[model samples]
Target: MEFLQQNWHWATLAAVTGGWLLIDTVRAKADKTLLSAVEATMLINREDAVVIDVREQAEFAQGHIPNARHIPFSELESRKNELEKLRGLPLILCCASGARSGNAIATLKKAGFEKLFNLRGGIFEWEKAGQPLSRGSKNKDKEKGKKK
Candidate 1:
């Protein structure tokens, strides 16, 4: 007791750490699965994954993965047939953040796409990780035309 009294601060720290670990353990099962950029790269390469940008048409035109298929969330239901060619392949979904991509996943899953993935933090993380962004003024030109 004398030793513990002398090291009350250490005792408090230990107790807090243990409590945090306990909470983490309990929360682990409830955690959402997230794919980091590295894991996403592997999945793309190994599985020949098809990346789908589910942002708005303007957002997608601004930028997207080089070979990604642009299927804006608003148009997914109507454009479902366009993605038929990619069925059975792993599909990675992305948006500005992750909300739209998450929704895209639900839509695709319901549409019977067996393999689906949500880019953990979306294009934001992809850019932050210094991944290559697609080039070509072609898409941008179309976007500008729409504004006028």
Candidate 2:
């Protein structure tokens, strides 16, 4: 009790941090829309969900989920009309990591994308899970090299 009194500031900080972590965990769990790579794949295959890669062109060219439509985060607002056809289907958003897609989710939700999901760990997690990536531009580069 005396030690805690002496280290009250430290104790307070630890308690606050723990509380924040608990809240974050609970919030994440409550959000049933966040999908793991495997879950996203199942949705894609079974429900015909549309995968939208919110990463920039360069990041996307490196590799992305197969058949993912590239609409850089910056252009999502203006180019959202391009995705009107997919509004009724489940829309899975992804980026290099998960941050960009999280932001994209906000934009999409505002646009009435109800059946939306953010890839929990993005393409990095998908690759880590040994899921295949479609290297669109890279394959072109390789083919060009062969021609030369």
Candidate 3:
């Protein structure tokens, strides 16, 4: 009690932060906003979820989820209008490790998109799960640039 009295501010801050984290977690769970690779595949197959690759062009050109629309995260806001047509469908955002796409969900939410989901563990998990990626144009171009 004495120690807490002297450190009450620290305790209050800790409690507040913990509460915020708890609520955020609960809300994410309630909304079913996060999707594992398998879940994402299921969503795609059953609901026709549109996968959005937010990695930069070079990264995306290396490989990407099949049929995923490429929209770098930095340009998501400006190019959001392109996604307006997909607004009513489930949009799954992904990146190399899922961090950028997870952060990007907020951008879509602000743009009035309701069915937004982040790919859990991103493309890494997708590959780990043995999901196939459509090799993009860069590989072919690189090969063409090399001459025997």
Candidate 4:
């Protein structure tokens, strides 16, 4: 009790942080929009969900989940009309580390997109899980050189 009195600020900060974490966890779970790589794969296979890579062209060109459509995050708002044709499909949004795609969710939802989902941890996590990546011509060229 005496030590806590001296460190009241620390205790308060800890408590607030713990509460924030708890709330975040609950919110994430309740939203159910964050999907693991494997789950995202299954969703694609079973439901034909559209995978949209929100990374910049350079990052996406390095490597991206197979069949992911490249739509840089910076242009998401402006290019939203392009997505309207795909509105009915379940859209799986991804980025380098999921943060950008996580944000894309609200943008899409506001556009009346009902089936938006975020790839939990994004392409980095997908690559970490040993999932296959489809690279642009640059990587293809490197692979071709290795073949020769």
| Each prediction's TM-score versus the true structure | 0.71, 0.78, 0.73, 0.76
Which residue runs does candidate 3 get wrong by more than 4 Å?
Answer: 1-31, 138-148
Candidate that scores best on lDDT: 2
Which numbered prediction scores highest in TM-score against the true structure?
Answer: 2
Candidate 2: 10-residue stretch with minimal lDDT: 133-142
Per-residue lDDT of model 2, residues 1-148, tens digit only: 9999999999999999999999989998999889999999999999999999999888999899988888999999999999999899999999988999999999999988899999988999999999999876646756987999
Q: Select the stronger candidate by TM-score from 2 and 4.
A: 2
- Candidate 4 at residue 71, lDDT? 83
- Tens-digit per-residue lDDT, 1-148, candidate 4: 9999999999999999999999988987887899989999999999999999999988988898877887899999999999998999999999988899988999999889999899988888999989999888445657887999
lDDT per prediction? Answer: 0.82, 0.92, 0.90, 0.90
Q: What value of lDDT does candidate 3 attain over all alpha carbons?
A: 0.90
Writing each residue's lDDT as its tens digit, candidate 3 over 94-132 gives 999989998789999988999999998889999999999
Candidate 3 — worst ten consecutive residues by lDDT sum?
136-145
Indicate the residue-level lDDT of 143 in model 1.
87
lDDT of 1: 0.82
Extract clashing residue pairs from model 4: none
A best-first ranking of the candidates according to their TM-score comes to 2, 4, 3, 1
Q: Better model by lDDT, 2 or 4? A: 2
